[model samples]
Target: MANTSADDLLRTARELFAVDGYQATSIGHIAEAAGLSKSAVLYHYASKEALLDAVLAPAEAGLAAVLHRFPQASDGNRAEFVEPFVDFLLAHRLEASIFINQGQSLHGIPVIDRANQLVQQLAHAVSSEFGSIADRVRFGVALGGAAYILAAQENWADPDDEPERDDEVRAALVDVVATLLTTTSTGIAATRGD
Candidate 1:
């Protein structure tokens, strides 16, 4: 290909890896898909793994941004803590395929580690309103399920297109999380004289 940018290569690589499985997607395949030579792809990314990293960078950044906002978002404004994250995960469903198809393959990678850490951060954010063990467990399950379902849910359209149930899913997700937080807050108040 002529004058293909690194981002163009990353977009092509994400498509290939999403459709072809990361294990099956080779540098050559990505190059051909991008209309570039294998060497051209290599010039920008040292390896297929590096290309995968580049492709997944946005998802990582999105989660990190959400984590950054956790401290400032109050319990009552739970949507402030959850909607951006739901949107982030939904937008990056293709990247989630790597986790679906290659679980252990990415175990020790920093990206995976950071994702786990973000999950913990989410747990902490949602649980910040209540100190009870039950509330912690409940919020952890609620937030974790919200993230997982968006990332792994069945796509009802072309893989390249956004999921058709965007508003439905977003509303249901926020509703569930709000219910969890409200229930926990009410319980804490009833029990602790708040």
Candidate 2:
């Protein structure tokens, strides 16, 4: 049941961090939310930052796993990475929201810095595959749009507990991002000069 307690603390921490803002959230708040004593929260996480780290660790690993497929992307197998990318974003919405909403202000924090690095790496990996600046822009738009959509939802106080909703959103996001990645530049992106 130790795993269950840790999971509860992580979940509570994530929701509180997203809803209350990370700086405003305290270890006590997480403990109270998880229906545990402060010492119990401490048993799982030495500090609020440790709790944040736990919440973000899976997302970091997930993004890294997605990045590992970038070589396949260069070989015209970009489709192989799209679903995993979306799945990572959907699975780590709260962590993404922390970066989206609080990253700049939280600079110098190791986890946030590492998260930013992963995002930059993702951009470089995606952009390096295509020649045109326009393709790079498409990559940026697709990534930015997907991240924004997932992160924005965390602002809602209501928890994301709906599997059907998750499935629908996940499918739509995968389709949209996959289509964007695959489509040839035919719009302003095509015509614009580098």
Candidate 3:
């Protein structure tokens, strides 16, 4: 049998998981898809759970880059977080979809656990930038909205086909994130005594 590296197995598995849903795709399916025997696949990734780590490693790296870039994401540096997140979502739409659509179910898995930690880090990073619990809630909402918009959008398997169109889509997302951060609600207190 032809030899397949771990990277090859991971790339194949990522696409399969995205299309078939993680639960539906098994180790055998991935091995067949990658033209490797089950043992060959197992040799690279000891278990199905480990395969997930390979699939999400790139996206995780992207998030890590954002965290490093803005060690402390601040009001003046909101773009540092928003822009890269948007880029990561766009660049890895399928992977991002699997993350958004079905991540909670994988709670016990280490990938999911680490991802949850990153999310908490992100929330803290944003809240630190914007004062008040209300503002923090807004930040969470903004991030959720941003993720949903991109993840739910069409899966452009090959974005290189239309660079201009992809650019337009990314620009719109960037605008949305910027608008969310800039807009703040001012409370209306009731008149004294009523």
Best by lDDT: 2
Per-model clash counts, in order, read 0, 0, 0
lDDT of each: 0.70, 0.78, 0.72
User: What TM-score fits each model?
Assistant: 0.65, 0.76, 0.73
Best model per TM-score: 2
Task: Rank candidates by lDDT, best first.
Answer: 2, 3, 1
* Weakest lDDT window of 10 consecutive positions for candidate 1: 96-105
Give the higher-TM-score candidate: 1 or 3. Answer: 3
Pitting candidate 2 against candidate 3, the one with the higher lDDT is: 2
Give the clash total for candidate 1: 0
lDDT of 2 by residue, 1-194 (tens): 38887788888888888768899998888888898999988876778888888888888888888888664464366766788888888888878778655777888878989988888887676555567777777787788777777766544536756434778889988898887787656544565852
Ranking by TM-score: 2, 3, 1
lDDT for each residue of candidate 3 in 33-74, tens digit (9 for 90 to 100) = 988899988877889988888788787777767777767766
Regions of candidate 3 where Cα sits further than 4 Å from its true position = 1-6, 129-141, 148-152, 155-164, 187-194
Per-candidate RMSD, Å: 5.2, 4.1, 4.9
User: Between which residue pairs do clashes occur in model 1?
Assistant: none
